[model samples]
Structures are given as structure tokens and as C-alpha cells.
Target: MDFSLSGLWHEMGLFARLVVIVMGIMSVTSLLVVGERLLVSFKGMSDSKVFASKLASLLADGPGRLDAAADTKFGKDIGYLGRTLRAGLVAYKGSVHGDKDLCFESVARALERQQARELAVLKRGHGWLATVGSTAPFVGLLGTTMGIITAFEKMAASGSGGLGTVSAGIAEALLTTAFGLLTAIPAVMAFNYLAGWVDARAVDISEASNEFLDLVARRLADGPSEEEEEGEESEAAA
Candidate 1:
């Protein structure tokens, strides 16, 4: 019997074929997830940097500049940080006229909620990669177990206990294990890399949110600026 992949494939039983097919699907799906997550991570980082730069300039201008956040265009290009900041700004604006502590608390809650949501979005699809990394090897082992059983059955029927009688079967059985490792290693690596990126982004968001809260505290301490008062008056007039 030919021991090449094609030859081994032909000799494989139905269960073995199904195992290969399942592993193949898993491999393809993992690659797709890796590509998608890398794209998202990179783009999100870039957009966040831009947003942060712009936000720094706005904050430097004065707390009243927060009004500009309402006019800022938010979309995929704005990224997660922009969304979180917008949520905080919206809360701050709505509650700025209320009790100072209540206003701060409202902004804090908004930031926290948005941060959790953004983290969830960043972690999307990670579970699948983890599942494949952890389970692919076991799935392959299951196929190998079935192949060995089939081989032993053949040997019993042939009334042969020779190495040659079982060697081919054992080799075919090991093939699934090899494929399983092949599928799993890359998935594990990808999951680790993406997880690191997500962790770093989480830190960035935490720091940014904290800084934003500090800015809010300072603004409240100073009370509403003249520009903010004028803006409110104009809105009230309208």
C-alpha cells in the first residue's frame, strides 16, 4: 500500500475522512479569524491615535470644547475610543447643569459601560480560535482511535499478527494526529497574538478613560466656562 497522503487518504475509513474534513474546516476558519482580527486591531489602533490627538487639542482649548464632540463624525473610522469618549461627552453635556457630583457620576458610568462594550467587540470571535486550539488535537485522536480499531479488525479477519499487517493501519491512524497538530498550533499562536493585542488596547482604553474623568473633574471644579454658558443660552433660545 502507498503511504503517501493520497494513498493514505484512499485507505482511510469514513470516520477518518470526516475527521480530516472537520479539521480542514477548522483550519480555514482560524485563518479567517486571524486575518479579520489583525485588520480590526491595526485599524482600530490607528483611528484611536488620531482621535486621541484631536481630543487632546480640544481639551486644551477648554472644557467647552467638549461640545465639539457632538459634531464629530463617528463611524468605523472613528474606532472604539471615539465611541467611548462620545458616550462620556454626551452624559457630561446632559448632566452638566445638574448637581456636580451627579454629573461626574453620570459621565463615569457612561465611560464604564462603553468600555465594557468595546472590550466585548474586541474579543469577538476569540472563543472559536480558543476552542479549535484546545479541541483539534482531541478530535484527531478520536479519529486515530477509530482507525486503529478498524485496522485491528482487518488484522483479525486476515488471521495475521505480523507488523506488516498493522503498520499501514497505524501509519494511517497517526496521520490524523499530525493533521490535528497542524491545525491547532497555528490557531493557538494566532489566539495568543490577538489576545495580547486586545490586552494592550484594554490598557489604552483604561488610561484614556481615567484621563477623561480627570478632565471632567477639573472642568466641574472650575464650573461651566463662559463659552459653555453662552452655548447653553443659545440652545435654550433655540
Candidate 2:
């Protein structure tokens, strides 16, 4: 009895083949999702660091530059952080004559909305990876159950209790189980890895938003810069 790959493949019944095919499709889908997720997560992480540094520089100039950050390519490339900050900045800058508390509330709301949207973008395709991880094994088990049923049917039809008679079905059952696990393990690992990255990124975005809000609050409390005061005094003298 040959247990080589080719021999096992030859023993696989139609149901086992179908199971293998389904697993193959799942594997391909999971791989694509993993690749896409890695790209998005890495790019977001990289851009976020750049955005943070540039934002610090811009804020050092004063809160007046918060609105201007959105127009720059650095802000645009900063992914979630940029978008979230832009939302708050726009709200803060627009609420000029409105109540200060209202303005702060607006910025916080904007930050929350942008954060949710960006997190959704980061989490895209994660559900599929999770589905594949959880279900592939069960699907394989279904194939194994079918194989066992076929083995019993064959024994009943042949009226013989020989090991050779049942070996083929058992081989098919084992193959499906093997393929199932092979497809599932990587998907589960990738899902966990990507999920962790996303969570960390979310935390970073949230913290950055909080920091931006604090800066905005402090700037508002400090009033206009010396440059603005000097210009006002000059105009009065003129």
C-alpha cells in the first residue's frame, strides 16, 4: 500500500476532492487578504509617524497652522492620524465665534467620527480571515465524515472486512484533515498579527487626537500670538 502524495491523491473520492478545492480557494483568499492587510497596516504605521513629527512642527508654530496641515502632502499621506486631526482642526477653526466649550465638543466629536472611519478602513478584510480560520477545520471535518461514511458503504457492498478495502477511504479522510489544518493555521496566525497591529494603530490615533485636543485648548486659552498683538498695536498707531 503506497502512502505517497500521488497515491493518496488517487484514493481521494469526489467529496474529498471538492473539500480540497474549497480549502484551496480559502487559502488563496486568505493569502490575498493577508497581503493587502499587511500593506495597509504598514503604510498607515509609517505614514502616521511622519504625520506626528510634521504635526508637532506645525503646532510649534501655533494653532493657526492646524488648518494648514490638511493642505500639505505630509498630512494627506499620514493616513488615519492626518484625517482625524484634520477633522478636529476644521471643527476648531470653524467655531471661531461659537462657545469655546461647544468648539471643544465639536472637535472631540469629529475626532471620534474620523477615528471610527479610519479604524473601519484598517479592519477591512479581517472578517474574512477570521471566517476562514474558524471554519476551514469544520469543513475538513465534514469531508472526513463523508469519507468515513464511504468507507462503511464500501465495506457493506463488498461483504469483506479487509484493511485494504477501508484504507483508501481512511487515506482520503486524513488527507482532507491535513489540507484543512494547512489552510487554517496560517490564516489564524495572520489574523492575530494583523489584528494586533490594527489595535495598536487605533490606540496611537486615539492618543494623538487627545494630544491635539489639548494643544487646541491651551492655544485658545493663551489667546493670539505676539505677532498678532504687535500688528494690532501697529494698526492702532497708524
Candidate 3:
């Protein structure tokens, strides 16, 4: 009764083998998701930093610089901050010369919508990881139950029940259990880590939106620009 891996593999019945194959697929899918999320998280963070720095510089120059800033390559990137800021800016632009209240409301709605979309993107594939983590063990338990049933069946058939007759089935149960834990531990860890990253990004986007709105408020309070006032005066004189 060799308790080695190859020996156990050979002894696994059809049901046990099917369970192992399913677990292997789950493991591979979890790994791929983890890698993709990590890559996206890191790239988003880096691009957001660049966009933030550029936005700050433009904002410092004055609210008038926002249009140009929004048109920049950085603003068009797929990062959370860039997309959110661009959405708000586009909304503001459409209503800039009209009602200030409407402009602010539009910008706020745009920010909220962009934030939801970005968060949703960040959360993609997270559910599957959670499902794999929570259910893999139970799946393995099902296999173990089947293996135990087979073991007892063999004992009943042989009529001379001994350790040799049942060890293979017990080995299958233990191996499946071990593989389940192996697949689940990393999946749970990755899900937690990625969730935290998404939260942090959300906070950053919220703060950026607030800062942008504050600038807009200041611009509105200042009233119309000198050029607009001059043009109105010329029209009146004509």
C-alpha cells in the first residue's frame, strides 16, 4: 500500500477523478484572475498618479485651464481618475455658459456615474474567486464522501475487510481534501487583496471629484469672465 502521489492517483475511481479535474480547472481560473487583477490594479494606480499631478498643475493655473487639461492625453487614459475627471469636465463644458446650478448638478451626476462604472470594472471576476474559495472545500468533501462509500462497498464485497482493501479509497479522500485547500487558500487571499485595492481607488476618485467641484464652485462665484462682460457691453452700445 504505497501512499505516494502516483499510487493514490492510480487508485482514484471515476467520481474522484472527475472531482480532481474540476478542482484543477478552478485552480487555473483563480490563478488567471489573480494575475489579471494585480496587473490592472498596479497599472491603474500608476496612471492615476500621473493624471493627478497633471490635473493639479492645470487647476493651479486657474479654472480656465480645465478645458485644456481635459483634452490632454492623460485625461483620455483608462485610469479611474482620468475617466472620472473627464466625465465631469465634459458635463461642465456642455452647460458652462448656461445655469451654474445645472452645470454643477451635471458634473456631480457624471462623477457618480463614472465612479460606479470604474468600481464595477475593478470588481470584475471577484465573485468567481470568492465562489471558488468558499466552495472548493465542499466540492472536495463530496468527492471524499463518494470515496468512502466506494471503500465500504469494496469491504462488503471482499467479506474479509482489511486495511489493504480500504487504504486506496481513504487515500483518494485525503488527496482531494488537500488539493481543495491548496486551491482555496490563495483564491481567498487574492480576493481580499484586490477588494482592498478597489476601495483605495474609490477613495482617491471621490477626493479628486470633490477637489474638482470645489474649483468649479470658486469659478462660478467669480461670475462671468472679463471677455464676456466686454462683449455684453459692446452689444449694448451697438
Tell me, by lDDT, which candidate is best: 1
Off by over 4 Å in 1: 62-64, 69-76, 230-238
TM-score of 2: 0.89
lDDT tens digits, residue span 96-158, model 1: 889999999999999999999999999998999999999999999998898799889879988
Candidate 3 local Cα displacement, residue 202, angstroms:
1.0
The C-alpha RMSD of each candidate to the native structure, in angstroms, is 2.3, 3.0, 2.0
In candidate 3, residue 211 scores what lDDT? 87
Deviation in Å, model 1, residue 45 alpha carbon: 1.1
lDDT of 2 by residue, 205-234 (tens): 888898888877876677665755887899
Worst 10 residues of 3 by lDDT: 69-78
For candidate 3, write residues 147-230 as lDDT tens digits.
888888888889968998887888888888888898889999999988998998899899989989988877777877676688
Candidate 3: TM-score? 0.92
lDDT of 3 at 171: 82
